[model samples]
Target: MKRCFTALIALTGAALPSASGQGHSALVQLQAHHSQADLEHMEEHAHYRYVGELLFYSSSFLVEEGGVERAATEQEVLGIDLHAHDGLRMVDQRIAVHDPLIDKHIILLSRNEFGALVLERLSPLDRDAFLANKRATMEQPSSKTQ
Candidate 1:
């Protein structure tokens, strides 16, 4: 079963379009390609489903600030908590990270083949939308199987 799954992933990854086009880095292409509709398209692949769950999750990020690389503080990591049920959302290779340090600044992070996390994009989340998402998640019942 493990071998079969691995084979499936290799094949599926090969079938996806090449994102390493000229002028744009692979990460940039992936970010641009993974719109809501593109994500829906990727959802059909078994590899996407399996690998999405298997990617690494980090609690602290080493980010460059003022010409110096420093680890992000807990507050700088945004929407990150050891006890929170879910902190990050991943689709394909991109994950959304919310940092509350600057008015809910959200960044999309991508995991490279070498397992390093890279920042792809940064966008601000409106306060109202953020609150709404929080409320909706809190209202949902747990889907735990056991």
Candidate 2:
């Protein structure tokens, strides 16, 4: 894993999780990655490219289609109608939330029971907890950007 600081976005050459529905093994093995502290520092510098990766660990998404609730890849969920509320089951990220505001979704790089990287969405509460972990990890950031 490598991350380059551009004008805004960090070119984090990262991708989806493993097939086993686990977390990002690449990121975890890397010496340096885009931690929440790095993102926060970038924000202080006003670098607001795509904040989605910052929420990588946040379970910020949920998908249940055709009365079948299963974890799906981002590609599999792409381009599905989300507003269908009736017998129509669809996939979407910008689902309505209790805050009366469109909830922005993010890809959560989590791990399944097999220790493989899996892509999923974190709940709001989980997202908050992830941020807290990020805040804690930022106290001693790593510089091994290899």
> Worst lDDT window (10 residues) for model 1?
114-123
Q: Against the true structure, what is each candidate's TM-score?
A: 0.23, 0.23
Once model 1 is optimally superposed onto the true structure by TM-score, how far is the C-alpha of residue 90 displaced, in angstroms?
A: 17
Please give the lDDT score at residue 40 for candidate 1: 41
Per-residue lDDT of 101 in model 1: 38
Among the numbered candidates, top lDDT falls to 1
Q: After superposition, how far is residue 99 of candidate 1 from its true place, in Å?
A: 22
Clashes per candidate (backbone, < 3 Å): 1, 17
- How would you encode candidate 2's per-residue C-alpha lDDT over 1-146 as one tens digit per residue? 12323311221223534322222321231113456675555444322222233223212334444544444343423322222321222233233222112222322222231111111233344345545555666775763211
Model 2 spans > 4 angstroms off: 1-59, 77-146
Cand. 1 Cα-lDDT: 0.32
Instruction: Score residue 92 of candidate 2 by CA lDDT.
Output: 32
